[model samples]
Target chain A: MSITSFIPPQRTLMGPGPSDIYPQVLQALSRPTIGHLDPLFIKMMDELKQLLQYAFQTKNTFTIAVSAPGSAGMEACFVNLVEAGDKVLVCRNGVFGDRMRENVERCGGIAIMVDNAWGEPVSPALVEQALQTDPDIKIVAFVHAETSTGALSDAKTLAEIARKYDCLTIVDAVTSLGGVPLLVDEWQLDAVYSGSQKCLSCVPGLSPLTFSEQAIAKIQQRKTPVQSWFLDQSLVLGYWSGEGKRSYHHTAPVNSLYALHEALVLLHNEGLEQAWQRHHRAHLELKTGLEALGIQFVVEEAYRLPQLNAVYIPEGIDDAAVRSTLLERYNLEIGAGLGTLAGKAWRIGLMGYAARNENVALCLKALESTLK
Target chain B: MSITSFIPPQRTLMGPGPSDIYPQVLQALSRPTIGHLDPLFIKMMDELKQLLQYAFQTKNTFTIAVSAPGSAGMEACFVNLVEAGDKVLVCRNGVFGDRMRENVERCGGIAIMVDNAWGEPVSPALVEQALQTDPDIKIVAFVHAETSTGALSDAKTLAEIARKYDCLTIVDAVTSLGGVPLLVDEWQLDAVYSGSQKCLSCVPGLSPLTFSEQAIAKIQQRKTPVQSWFLDQSLVLGYWSGEGKRSYHHTAPVNSLYALHEALVLLHNEGLEQAWQRHHRAHLELKTGLEALGIQFVVEEAYRLPQLNAVYIPEGIDDAAVRSTLLERYNLEIGAGLGTLAGKAWRIGLMGYAARNENVALCLKALESTLK
Candidate 1:
């Protein structure tokens, strides 16, 4: 049973996540591993928090990365913010929103799901109406950018309604943080979570998270202990925060944090607005090419996410065969539709370093040839 | 706020965990990122499972790495196996055992603790006595090697007692795997969790876990849903297993897994018994040097872990000053004591790649100069 070292093929990632990592970020990941409690590593953590604050456009001091993936980040927010018997209005437009509902229910919170069509943006009016109907709802949760459908909800508008109803908002910014406009402070978002694998273009293990003052208050006043010891942000805060002698929680993924730090540094250098513009421009190029190929997008132009383009599979086209051809023949990857859109739609990503004209061109040519 | 790319100083890590990583493992981490759902990535995952099984010395088909760190892996084992009303006999000898108790309570299980001295190994006789007294106890949980105190508990004897009482066992092999003799199948450990950072010398972030069929059966027959959506082993099993189409759970930490795979391959190549012997030899060399310097070990000679050596700080020597000097002057890092031993002892690790004659000599020379 001798297994040799694995050497993976280099493929252009146009999938929903784990987009092309910058060379510097990859180099950072291979850098020397240090102790989690090391002073230098802690200094890096403080900088990472500040960079995450900049990316989310939030002054929230609670911004930090979860040691796990985006899903754990989502769980951290829910378990900390939503106590038992709390009513959370979960706006479900795509897979992530449904996941939010699952998180709420698992935390013993009642999930009042406000449903929307698969590729449609979460309607602010519907959220308002739901909140008005259920004044008992203490939190309103929604995905700012649905990676499952390429639909971008109006987070600012939705957050405004949540605030108007006197409810704290939990936002899934997993696919939107760097690719689109997501102002946590401006939107008054109480709890927000994003993925390192998405627009950050870092590797896929860590989850960047932030909590507003109100969110912190809710957690502080909670009667029940957070069910998950690992995801409990209260205990985690002691480790990530304080001046000197931070408490030890779990071991921080040292090298992964380095990769995230470099990725965030790159983001800081490019400027958030410029990065968003680049994603949009890449989307436009891919859109034009797909239009020439007679492929139709699942989402409307007004609400589609620039980084993630979910398009309907061409009629009579075999979904698996085309994706396999693209992977095997062209060494390219495009995401298959999830949940309700499965086998019918394909998600093409242009995120972070992958949000470039070269990637768009390669993906277009690969799809065109594969479809033929 | 202007922040540049973080360039970490190269330091020799001789801490309790996140010990010196193999250069090849670090190189593996820098490899290009791939989509979590890529077929090639899935193939690598399959090989990774085999490598983990080899490290664990088990044929339990349920072995896989948890996406989070070792603490999360501990939570996964408890949440899946112990239900709300179940009675779990938690043996507390060091920091990790107390953490195990916390996990048990958080999972809604009643924790009946069997206490031992901080620097002492868990007594198998006491474990048998506790099981005899509590007929309702469903599981017995203990740490094989306590990183905090450098004590190696008798896992085989404890497992024998647990099975005699018709109970399953949850063993913390975080600091034991690869550094010492841990026979999972032979001891019949029901649920075992380990960290990549410890004896494996991989980067921190991933936890390699395995469950015997008995443990799996208990999880499968559980009355309540596992509290954590992210840490739920049942849901994660779908993603890690099956022949053709693997389900997507969370986006796996791709690069970390690559490093773990390479680390495990190296371990397999070295042979587990040979690795264990190497750690012991390194420990003896370190012990001889420390004794010459008039430093004393915290744990007794018979039960001390070869990987983690907790030593008393020499009289009048400032703990932080010595550690800081080691870091600043020699570019070396050793662990400060945790929990009960804090401020009194220093934990010097000789695990995996760090268990070498050169590292021992360098650490000894650094400590001697720092003390002076």
Candidate 2:
């Protein structure tokens, strides 16, 4: 088989995640890969933790990137916090929330799911009720921003309710971390995880994760070892922790970390609040344009995530046909609906570097022309 | 914390893994980010699989890269095959073998370990003896090439022994793939995993893995769900499988895959056997130079890995000081010994792109000056 070098076509990514990456981040990714245990690389890791802490708006020292994707970060949180027979109240609003339940089950933990409609936010009241009904529920888990449906839950309120019930909270901030306000410390989120490809606008693969002292304490007190050795936070702590000389765990994805560092630097320079507002402003523009074209959004305005806009496919309009046309003709990528909304909706993302006036206009124009 | 952009200093990497990456591979990594589901990206993914199959010298349809590092790939093999209460025969020749035992125990499988001395190859006779003693052993696991001690085990003979006992095999080819003759299909190996960073000379996140049909059948017949949801190969198979349409398991590390594709392409272009010979030739050059400098090799020549050279530090020489001097003055990175050999040995790697005459000369010259 004669296989040559693969040259990927450049496209405007308006998908549910993996939004347009900053040019600098891409450049950083191409930099020379150094030894993961090199002193210089270790120094960069420390800086990366600080940058992630700033982005998550937390003082949690356990903040570091998992070497895999967002799902692994989700798995890391559950496998480390939930032990065998431990009852966890998982709020299932969208795909990620359901994934949390799977993580819990795989870790041998009992999941008490609080179901919500696909296009709606996780109800804080329902979560509170579940925890109250099952006082044995040791941890509460929910997605802060559902990438599947563009729904944003009230993470602070949900976390507060979990705290009131004396339960630790695990938050999936994959789509919310940089595009919206995610005050991990203020919300008292014990465990939170996100993807680098989402609002962070870095390449996919690395998962930015943070854990509170309570979460670390729970891990330290585990009766059984974490099922997945790659995800076990107790062991990973030795490598990421700055207390002593860094120990060899696995080879850190050196270049990906470089991209994440550059992306975080851009976010810090832009200012977190400013970046969130930029996403919101772009969403408003896109919403107005879509409304003018008679397209309707899936989630209500109040609970909608600015970065991820899920809109119902108009009646009699073929979903695949429209997305295909946009991809082929315009070199634009708008996500197909996932899970429950597979054929009924389309997810248009305005995340990080993709959250710009030009991208919004291009997407609106492309959709209008394609529909016509 | 005002952390600006992290500019990593370029160093000549002579480490056990994360050896010098090819420049083209680095360029491929920085390409504009694309969606994981982008049709173009999927095409690249298919090509990547073919390239990996060529490198491993296997036509196993189950070949794919694990989203994490080599350690995670090891976890995937054990978690999918060895169920709770299943008996596994693990051979401990170096650090990775003991890690395999950890993986087995974490999966609730009983590991009957056959101990071999560090810096020595795993004895196929001992493995046959262990499997013979434990008729119930479902699998035999060993590292084909030990990065810790630079010992190259006889994978072909060991796999033959395992098959003779009606057992599957798990081989860690992290430091062997693309650097030596790893005939996966010819040897009838069941399951094997490798690191992209090692001999492949790609960046360090992804793990190239291949599983024989027998291994897949065993996974399909598992009594319980794979303990780690992230590493559950059965689920990942849907994403990597070239069936109707690729399902989303997790966002593939898009850019890292690009780098791997390019690295594998370079390997294919050079011919796998040619690449192996290059590594061997570089090792000879390095060996002559190190011997001239009064250094001693840790592993005997018969079973030593050409890609990884573990050598003893001279008496009265401070281990850290020499390495530090090499780093600071020469901008070169050499690996300190790991596990049992730590502080007593230095590992100089000649893998993939780093396995060249120029690199050997630089490493030898750097070592000579630092020792002086």
Candidate 3:
């Protein structure tokens, strides 16, 4: 019970998330605490919304950060959009998709799961079939980038299909938002949510969420009050939106928002396309280096996420042993496969600030030495 | 929208919550971002739970910080303990109590609100009457310290009455936790939630939550799933609990937890009773100063919360102007009254790190100058 001051070790974070946080964002987090309704904080909120809009590639005015993590952001989309007795088509390929189904069920919505194997993208054909089979489906939900398996689904195509079927689409862009090309406006995504910790490389906790007019309409016209009041976008709108005075919902995570603002600022400084390309380049370099070490990627090349690479644990090499050696020896953190892929895979992340030549080179050299 | 870097002004935060965070906590927040599942981070997680337990004075193994604000923590308690069709007695005195009713209803539970006037404490007699009138009430919920009105309810007596009525007690300790006396184990409270920003003096995001064995039993035996997956305590326990390897749930707010840990560590170093006395002394000094300036407190002395002082604006004085002048001139941030009391009163906080002689003296001195 004698706990003292914890000075956490500085590590090169290449885990699923939080990826390497830029110094600017980390510094922003320690900024003086401001009242949530302070005029200056309100101004910052307005700019944060715009920055998120830029990152999400959407003109949706309903864009704001949820006061919790990405999982809560995912829940906010489902609980607010999917009312009781509503039928939702949830595409389940990995952990996050399965989580979407859980959200749907928890909200008393009937979830019609469109299943795909782990390490594989959700089949657009299968999703269309599910939507067709359940003609009364109100929402089509799927993860765009599955962190649990490093699989990137065709969000643009899936969103297009959902729109064709007149179903509101909910996309989990947690790992993909700043790393991949996602046009919320062009793809017509009804609701999109992302983690701050991913390619944005901010601290975890704040979840950036955006809802199109269609999704906002559904939330506004909900048959029942939103199940979670803290996450209800309608109420949240009072605080995050304004031409003059912003209203109070819950206390906005002021310092965390500062971190997000700085993260988004960094992303804005480096154009979104350039950040995405950097992630892709880093992924290729890591891919080349890992392949030379006889490691195999679980996700097929086309389906893989550039920010997160899930590779098979070398045959007969212990999962915990290898990860332990890397963490202890190199001060580097890579993800262990989660859910069904646990022990079978390791996720090497190259995200935001971590998506650089030096980080990739260090990871390669470290792995080479650790394996030897 | 060309937004430049946000360099926030350093103000002395004297708001309802987020009352001047400790420098140590702020520095802890800027510590390097680490993997949520990193072994060292997990070790910190275990220590955080223990620190929370000490703060709560509870042996309940389910204690943990919700990765959101107090509002989400409030929702977590309701959504987990309550099932659809369950009857709960909610006490409404101020803003937070009304929110409890919202949570109960959102969870599909029937809320029997025992209303009290604003700025008044929750009536134990009324709560007992409601419980007796409706024996089917499975839970009795109330706020220990009402932030909006600076009223402290008789949580211990209410808990005792609830126990007599065979109902589990759900207490909101958001503003009361590190400022007032709360004996979770001795009082036999079932569930309690607090905010890090309040008396804890941490940056405003994380919510420290603890559930008694009775509440845990209720959650485990529930027939229905917790509505919000992110707030679901059952699933979260797997992530926060464990002897060695913790399971992955949502990514715990890595850096926010660091801030909370430091805040709690600060609390532990300062004896809890000594901290409460400090807040009381500061409140008395502020109150005396305010009274001398003809400012009337909203709550009576007996029911007043030492941490939050709710005082009415003097006759014909513009609320916004005074607050603005204080902010612009003195770099001091005070809270505007919320909900029913909005524009009528200003809340002066003397909690955690802000509960110091100098802060109170400075606040009084600043008010004198601003009013003149």
Candidate 4:
């Protein structure tokens, strides 16, 4: 039983998530682990919620980080809001949207899926049609940035349409939050969830989430109990909200939360607009280089996500062979296509700390050789 | 908007959990984050499962870490095993047991609670009687070690009793797993969940869970969909099992899993029994010092957990003042009481890497000075 400590190889993480974490964030993670209920930890939590709110651009009082990953954050929204027999309109454009439909079904809600093409952004017109056709719909759910296809939907327009039809909105900002422009409060996004790993430049765990007053009202008036105890936002609110001694819910991934705090702090230091522009600039550089190489983007240029670039693989390129060669030879990792795009497209991410000119140049250099 | 990076103070952790993480584990946590589907990461995942199996003392193929805290692991067992309308017998000796009843109720199961006094072990006689009274009970759930009260229940005997009644057993080994002797396979415990931050000496956020074949069978035969999309064992199994090409569920907490792998590796190096003895030896030293200072244990001596010692505060002692002084003056951290024990007792934990003679002596000395 002489097992030595696992020393993971350092690779350039240019995938959909588990994005390149900042050195400060990694150092924060290695800090002395503290009791979840320690007073200083609670104070830090308060600052974290504030930092998350700044990133989310929301004044939602219920803003906090779930101790799990983005999927749990997605589940938290569905399980807490979608009670049995409730009708929800889910827009399906990529893998995450399909996961949303599954979440609805598992929560015992009736999902009316508005289907869009795999690489296309979710259409507000289609969602409006679904809402107009089904007046019983209680919620409108869609992915802001579809990680699988690099499509960025117009969340503001979608939220506006849902509000016009008297339905709450749940936005999956997992790949959007710090990487793109997302004004949660202005959009009136009722419930929003994002991953720390994608745009926050933190380790993969802990989902930053916020619920508008309307969403809180919906949760408060839920007819049926939330299916999962760990995700019950009503109970979790007691632990995350209010002043003075917060109630204990589950153990907050103390170290991960610390890393998230630091990541968000970095985001704040960089300024949200600069961060978004940095991602866009880096994306432009990578996109131009890839275009010169005869690569085509899966998503249309107008709707393509700045942080996640989904490019089609050349007909003769072996997907696994190319990716493995890149990993082994250059120590670089780009995401393989997910779901319907599998074997057809590649996803190269320019997320958070990884959205730099140096990273973009390295990726292009690596790809130029790998393609030859 | 001017938020500096969070630099957490270094405190000697003597709490119920997030217990003084091993330096190796912390280093592992700060390792370069990898893609969840990275081949090397997958190889590490297999090793993690094997280490977890060894720690669980089970060869259950379903042993893996849930990318959340222990509370979610507890919910996973209840939501996956106790279907809607099923009757589950929950033994409530402390806060965690009551949390089990909540999980059962949230899962839409009828909870037949066998109440034991707080600060006491779950009585086998009462559990047996509950089983006799409730023939419809499909599952039995209890805490192996109650964190709130420092009481350790006999999981082996309890599992035997549940099996004798033809009921599946769900054990909460959150504060027990790496600290005490828990034979999952030998006791026929159907489902078990543990925290990484406890005696595992890892950073918090991940839950190590294992399910026996019988439990897997029950989950597979479930009539209704598991209430949680993220926690549905059937889907999670796809990601954790098989030889190659693991399916995508959620992005695993890559670095946290790295830390857990290192923690379990450390445990394997020390040997589980030796780790348990270290906790016991440290607890005895702490107990003697505490007793000499006129402090008494909240739990009875025979039933107390070695890792978590719930000791009553001496008369005229102010809990907050003493804890604050320790943190400020000596950079030591101890736990405050929880639930009914709140304001009345202090929980002094001797767990995993924190279970050392130096730590024990330091804690006693800090308390001696703080009390003065």
Q: Give stretches of model 4 more than 4 Å off.
A: none
- For model 1, what share of native contacts is present? 0.78
Mark the 10 consecutive residues where model 1 chain B has the least summed lDDT.
B242-251
The DockQ value obtained for model 3 is 0.84
How much lDDT does candidate 3 score?
Answer: 0.91
C-alpha RMSD of candidate 1: 0.8
Q: Which of the CAPRI classes, incorrect, acceptable, medium or high, describes model 4?
A: high
Q: In model 2, what are the clashing residue pairs, if there are any?
A: none
Taking the tens digit of each residue's C-alpha lDDT, what string does model 2 give over A1-372? 888888878899999878899999998888888889888899999999999999999999999999999999999999899988999999998888889999999888899999999999998888888887989998999999999999999999998899898999999999999999999998899999999999999999999999999999988898888888899888898999887799888889999999999999999999999999999999999999999999999999999999999999999999999999999999999999999999999999999999999999999999999999
Per-residue lDDT of B30 in model 3: 96
RMSD of each: 0.8, 0.8, 1.1, 1.1
- Residue pairs with colliding backbones in model 3 are none
> DockQ for each candidate?
0.85, 0.87, 0.84, 0.85
Docking outcome class, model 1: high
> DockQ: which candidate is best?
2
For all predicted structures, in order, the TM-scores are: 0.99, 0.99, 0.99, 0.99
Predicted structure 2, TM vs. truth: 0.99
Error of 3 at A34 (Å): 1.1
Candidate 2 per-residue lDDT, tens place, B1-372, comes to 688877888888998989999999999888877888988888888898899889888899999999999999999999999999999999998899999999999999999999999999999889988888889998999999999999999999999899889999999999999999999999999999999998889999999999999999999898999988899998998998877788988999998999999999999999998999999999999999999999999999999899999999999999999988988998888999999999999999999999999999999988888788
lDDT for every model? 0.93, 0.93, 0.91, 0.92
Interface RMSD of each: 0.8, 0.8, 0.8, 0.9
